[model samples]
Target: MTTREWAGDAETRQVTEVASERELRELIGEPNDRAANKIRSRLHDLDRQWLARSPFCYLATADAEGRCDVSPKGDPAGFTLVLDDATLAIPDRPGNKRLDGFRNILANPQVGLNYVLPGRSDTLRINGRGRILRDAPFFDDMVVKGNRPRLALLVEIDEVFYHCSKAFLRSQLWQPESWQPDAVPSRARIAKGIEAPDIPLEQLEAHYGAGYADRLYG
Candidate 1:
């Protein structure tokens, strides 16, 4: 589709775009002074506590060319190790070997992480530089089911803060009654369109399910 068609129309595009920070700030108004001041350049004790209780987080990274990706990382609570006030170590669990986000981190050290807990509305956000570590000591600490990760992402903190609960409140994300059931296509089904079409759907599902069910750890 053409740019104009994809963006709705010229008027819609013009209305949505704010060309400069000045213009954007004018539209949204200044952020809260207290909120702005709350952002820490390092992880504090409270931040460490939050990470300790978080079983899931989203790791966001962008390549040198600015191509971005967000990948979900989850484990038991406290799976992410706070190596100190300034560093965090996240084990790179076994997966399909795409490594899109990890490759982006190699090209561009900058990364963002958002930590979430099951019933909590507020999420902790961490912005930092990342490096891949394959050292035995790093992997030794993150072993799961006798399987140690072959690699870990070490993050040096730059900014850390708690995002407000407005988003979760608006979506009612934690409320079961607010959720709607839907039939979601499996990854195998989606891949068949662009990949191995000759593979039977049942075979693909069986393989995929078994991998997730039995081989989650590396």
Candidate 2:
């Protein structure tokens, strides 16, 4: 069958697969000049500026067993403190206390961070080793709205780089005109599918709202 005919006939189409690094390289070839040269092992002045203006980041971590998790962290701009060229710190705010990220740090110190700023097409990526600290001087410096974070994640930088804008450009992430209307499922509707179908949704929502306002600070 021709390529188009093979695609059209589902029964004859076994998954087109590349099972090894050699096959992968044959398929995609090598990176060009800019792609091969963009990575940096240490933070630079421009990287610091990008991080300082960012209010949000996604943190990726894995436990000793290699179970992985990614969690969102957000606060006011520059909430993440660049302690030096080789170290950074992020405050831990109060939340549901699942501690998935924190627990992973204890078992496996390696972490990956992607910092994003609104309206900015490029993002900063950092790979590091993390440790949880409660040292008074360091933890006390992260006070927000008169509340100090009980813990802070101190990351020793290993690698840092600026990822290009292809992803955001393809998704039109910063274009309000291309956005769809908010159609988020209700908390109650989500809860019903999980573990608690019998409880009233109103009570769950009210409790969540109150906790959001009252326990937001750490």
Candidate 3:
């Protein structure tokens, strides 16, 4: 595959530097002026539903140069391992090819997460320090999609917060009774873009069907 270009350029967004860590901490003392409610949260805050019911999550991380990648992971509820009052471990399942997110974690452990419920409006956001592990019992714990995951990532919860689901509420994310998939992007279209030297479209798809089950279940 060719190098993928970023959709947005740096010039598109305004960037500003906060003076210092100490200055930012000092500023957190004052309460919010927004409304009678919706106050900013502290580190120790833990919302139960955020951990218990989320079947899907997005992980965001960047390298030292600020080039970033966000990866999506999903499983049944309780797939994530709560290492403690302050840590979480998400098992890395099998994938098609790339390992961009895992590589970024090695370069910069600073990471962020957005956890969304299947049909719930509210979402949880967590920013934490993380590391990747490739050991046994840990992998065996979060196993799903059949085989044990080869690797798992652990994140120390430095911050935990939630977004009021105005966007989701308005869009009726919980109204799954009206949901629809956008489309099935064809392998031909994808191969035309990536110029993968794999095979003809029919053969490629057949290979996926025949090869995937054996690798995952064989």
Candidate 4:
């Protein structure tokens, strides 16, 4: 089929598959349901406290191989620094030498970022075109002691939205007073368990801990 015809055919819905409200909403569930009212247009600016309150985030990217990578980034709330309404910069904190996320960016410029706020019920999701920025852009994010990062990844945001962290609230994510130690695994021990063919996970942990102090903020 021609390109236009193929696109049309894909969008044409069969009338036989009509869905019942109970079946649809029940399947979609409450948390996944659309909000009664939603904001239009992306907010170019970020509220300062959002960055200050966030302790962890996940970076998602897809490479030419069609394999996708999702990596966790964390720090004392505010490791991610927003430069302006149009640009957001993340300090490339050191990790295992794998650099899977960075490598994927070289082959694919698209990225999805989810910034999670600590003890809060809302998170930020952003989709953007990203590029590696150097020199001043990199230096501006430096810490008082760590020096500066070699470079920073600059993301030119296309769209951004806030998600209600209903699940987190239901799970009592931030209620540290009631949290059980067994709920979360110790990073050090968890790292010691994984044994990859190419690189031992324990070795990766050692390298990450050694370099993180110097790479982040510095």
In model 3, what lDDT does residue 55 have? 80
Best by TM-score: 1
lDDT per residue as tens, model 3, 1-218: 12334446554544444567676767666546553354333433355546777788999999878899999988788677776677788988778658888888888899999888777777888888888888857676776656677788988877777777899978876786767644655555577457765666776666555565566423
The regions of model 3 sitting more than 4 angstroms off are 1-46, 170-184, 192-198, 207-218
Candidate 3's TM-score: 0.69
Per-model TM-score versus the true fold: 0.87, 0.85, 0.69, 0.66
Q: What is the lDDT of residue 164 in candidate 1?
A: 89
lDDT of 4 at 149: 64
| Pairs of colliding residues, candidate 1 | none
lDDT of 4 by residue, 165-192 (tens): 7878788878888688878655555655
Candidate 1's C-alpha lDDT? 0.87
Q: Whole-model Cα lDDT per candidate?
A: 0.87, 0.87, 0.74, 0.71
Off by over 4 Å in 1: 1-16, 186-188, 191-196
Candidate 4 C-alpha error for residue 21, in Å: 16
RMSD to native, candidate 2? 4.6
Query: Comparing 2 and 3 by lDDT, which wins?
Result: 2
